[model samples]
Target: MMSKNTQADRNPPADKTAGQTKPRGKGKKYLVGLPITVWLVLIIIVPILIMFATSFYKKVGSNIEPIFNFGNYAKFFTDSIYIPIFFKTLLLALAVSISSIVLGYPLAYLVSRKVKRFRNQLYMLILVPLWVSYLVRIVAWRAILGRGGVLNTLLLDLHLIKEPISLFIYNPFAIFIVLTHISLPFVFISIFTSLEKIPKNLINAAADLGANGPRTLKEIIIPLSMPGVLSGFTMAFVTALGDYIIPQQLGGPNGLMFGNLIVSQFGYAYNWPLGAALGFIMFGIAVLILTLSNKASASEGYLE
Candidate 1:
């Protein structure tokens, strides 16, 4: 009995330290993550909460009152001008997403699958625009689309017309063009990454089974790349939806987007409550798009 008791004391139990160790490790992990959690709360959560609360506040004669009401939200639905602009913005954003995908997918496919040499150079060229200032890119577009810009000069030199066309700038088409250019890189990157991740062995196997390039692409590559396509679509849609600068700069009279409307409420309109409501509506739409994209990505992963 004495020997057995001594042995038991020496061994104790395996779980004795296991529980302590696991909890200690978890506690350390939590402690390490605490700063990130705090940062997100302070930067993101706090601001969103503040905006949400402010959305319910009353805007009384250029000053915002702390009074809680649903007037701002109601005003959005009740206002005729707001709803039409919102729908128009939605259609424009959708068009931008489609255009980005159409333009970007070919470039991404060429870079990922077709190109052998100068691939890195091409990739860098694609991303180089992102390094430039956003406003600079907008200004560059203005310069190109402006009356005396390169297009007009080229057209004049070619004798396509006697004069430069004013149709290029300060129109809905100009807005579409600029937004597509801005969004193309993001879509290309997403699709390129997806294409790169496709296992070479799978393609070889398809070839071994006598599958042609087009068939393999249609059956395998395109389906696998759906996640990236969806992700890129979401990014383009969100970027175009919330952009006021491009619309304001290029949209002229017909260029007033939902984002411009929201900005107007905050800037010149002096209606903080209404602005917050509009901003939150946009934020919700972005969140919804992201959520859907994530789910689609996950579903694709599961199928793969």
Candidate 2:
């Protein structure tokens, strides 16, 4: 017969330590995330909520007085001035999106399929301008496109024109050019990532099945890469639409966009409610674009 002590030794007590460890780990994770959660709530969410609240209130004298009326929103619809600028902004955004997609797709494809070596080096080259300050780039463009600037100087020296052209700077076209140049790398990077995800064996199999280069790219590559294209377009469009600085600097009196008008309301106009309403409208449009693009991308994605 076994002793009482022997029976007790065979079965040790269940571990309480293991049970407590999971809860401790969870607590630690929450502790790490607390700062980020607090910061976002205080900075982004709070400000946005305040802005939304302020949108409903009217400006009384120098004070933002509270009112529950749809007059601000109503003005946007009835007033012809704001509506045209808003549509113009949308049109400009669409143009910028198309231009980015067209320019990015080819460069991304080249890097992914054709470049045998120094591929990363090429990517770094594309990213160099991005790392520099955005304001610096805008200023640089201003200098380059100015009447007596680099392009004109070169043209004048080469006897291409009798005088410097005033057509280059302080115009909508200049805004378009600068925005495209800066936003190009973002689109390229997104598309490049998508291209990299594609399997090499698919291309090889297509080739083995008697598919030519153009045929493989047409049916296989382009279909698979549409998501990246959509992403790039959305990014470019949103960035271009929300940019007040670019339009302010480059867009002349006739070329003033929706963003500038919104700024005017906040500045000397002193109409906080109106500005907030316009901002909300702009945000809503951007969100709508993103949502629609996402749906389209999702529908197209399953084919792969």
Candidate 3:
């Protein structure tokens, strides 16, 4: 009669073979992920590092020579023009993000809460605008907002205004309008995904607990969907901050953003060093906002 321990060792667990006791082979797994890891390092990480390195350098004469100097960053900080523009751009992006969220949340909720049969159709409708060319959308808005344009004609026909509003095209308002339209879809999609994750039983349970519509939405829905809202806002904010095309085309003098200024430095001004520094500053702001958002979300237990 063998002892219990001796018998157990003789017949080990079915899931653990003698070979299984040894370390598993990591070779195949690493090989599978190696290509993607390499691509990301080469394409994304390397470029970011290069940009960071270039930010510390200054341009010399008309040549493409970069002299290691902090003057570019110093100029950005001390120069009244750049600092104010940076703040203004940040403010504008925040406004756009807020506006997009405000407009997107309700639409997303409505679509998400609808019957399954209708949900797909509604989602497609919302996404249809994404298929359209961004440039075409901006140009269409330009035509509608231009003097003697559709809006002006309609208002004139209604005798609402004595003359076409000159403030519509080539203005900050135009830039805001275009940016909002472009960003609305991103917010809507993000919020919709979050709304969809919510179990119907939880909502039913809320109702069973005598929770009213407003109370349930405020206490349950909003908190659960906060992650999506934050993500959408971050995406829209960052994109709007770095937007060059819409502002360049629709914006007149007043509509010019920091992105436009950065582009000018790299292009016409031939000040690559200053441009790199400004780009790095923008990167810093984006990182700070994202980090703060992450911390806040984590504190709220919504970062999972």
Candidate 4:
């Protein structure tokens, strides 16, 4: 019996399997991230570096040179033409954002709360315009708002005005209308997501606690959906601020945005450095606004 036990114990230690070993320290974690790291460096990091480098150069007699001058930036701040255009663009973006929110919230709430079976259908309808080419949409609006367009015809039939209003086309009003229509889906979708996240139990709980419909909405639904509202407004604002095509097509003269100015600098003006500077300035302004909005949301206890 002792001899048999000794033999068995001697054979047991003959081999240890590879699967029995513990994993080594930090095994290949960075390797998994290598592709993403390369992509970010290629796409985002390199472009930003190029933009920064370009901002310091100047166009001199058909040649772009690395002058290391602040002339571009200085011109941006001191030039009367560009500065006012920048402010106008900011105001226009703000107006578009606010108007989109005002018009979108109610529609989103109604779609989310009131429509159950047709919710997907309604969402599809809202998003259908996006599937069409953006240029086509702008052209369609132009046709509808033109002098001999549907609006003018309706007004003429109704006798609202003796003549077709030029204000309806090729003006700031046209820009505002087109931009708001383009941005409405974004706001609506954001708010719809927030509305969907609200628990029915919370509404029931509020009702049971003797809170009326308006009180429940004001105290609970509105506060809970603040993050989505902020996100929607931010998206709408940024889109409106950067949009050049809509303003260019629908806007006669005063509807020009900073985007138009930037494009002109890069195109006919041949002022690459100034365009780069303006782009950076716009980036800084957008970052500042987003940061302030985030802080305000946090202060209001709406951010997690």
Which candidate ranks first by lDDT, i.e. highest? 1
Quantify all predictions' global Cα lDDT against the true fold.
Answer: 0.88, 0.84, 0.83, 0.83
Name the lDDT value of residue 228 in candidate 1. 88
Candidate 3 ranges beyond 4 A from true positions: 1-25, 115-117, 299-304
TM-score result, candidate 3 = 0.87
Span of ten consecutive residues with least summed lDDT in model 1: 1-10
Q: In candidate 3, what residue range of length 10 has the lowest lDDT sum? A: 1-10
| Winner by lDDT between candidate 4 and candidate 2 | 2
**Candidate 1, residue 179: lDDT:** 97
lDDT of 3 by residue, 1-304 (tens): 1122232443445445665665457887788789999999999999988887887776777864657888888988788899888888888898999999999999999899855687898899999989999989988998899997999999999999998988888988888888999999999999998888765766776789899999889867887787788889988999899998988899987877899888988866888778888888888889988887777655543321
Cα-based lDDT at residue 235, candidate 3: 85
Question: What is residue 277's positional error in candidate 1, in angstroms?
Answer: 0.4
Total clashing residue pairs per candidate?
A: 0, 0, 0, 0
- Please provide, for model 1 over 1-304, each residue's C-alpha lDDT reduced to its tens digit, 9 standing for 90 to 100: 2222323433445557766756456678999899999999999999999999999999887789999999999988998998899989999999999999999998999999999999999999999999999999999998998999989888989999898999999999999999999999999999999888776766776788888999889867887778889999999999999999999999999999999988998767888888999999989989998998999887675222
Which pairs of residues collide in candidate 2?
none
Q: lDDT-based ranking, best first?
A: 1, 2, 3, 4
- Residue pairs whose backbone atoms clash in candidate 4: none
Model 2 weakest 10-residue run by lDDT: 1-10
What candidate 1 gets wrong by more than 4 Å, as runs, is: 1-24, 302-304
TM-score of 2: 0.87
**Would you list the clashing residue pairs of candidate 1?**
none
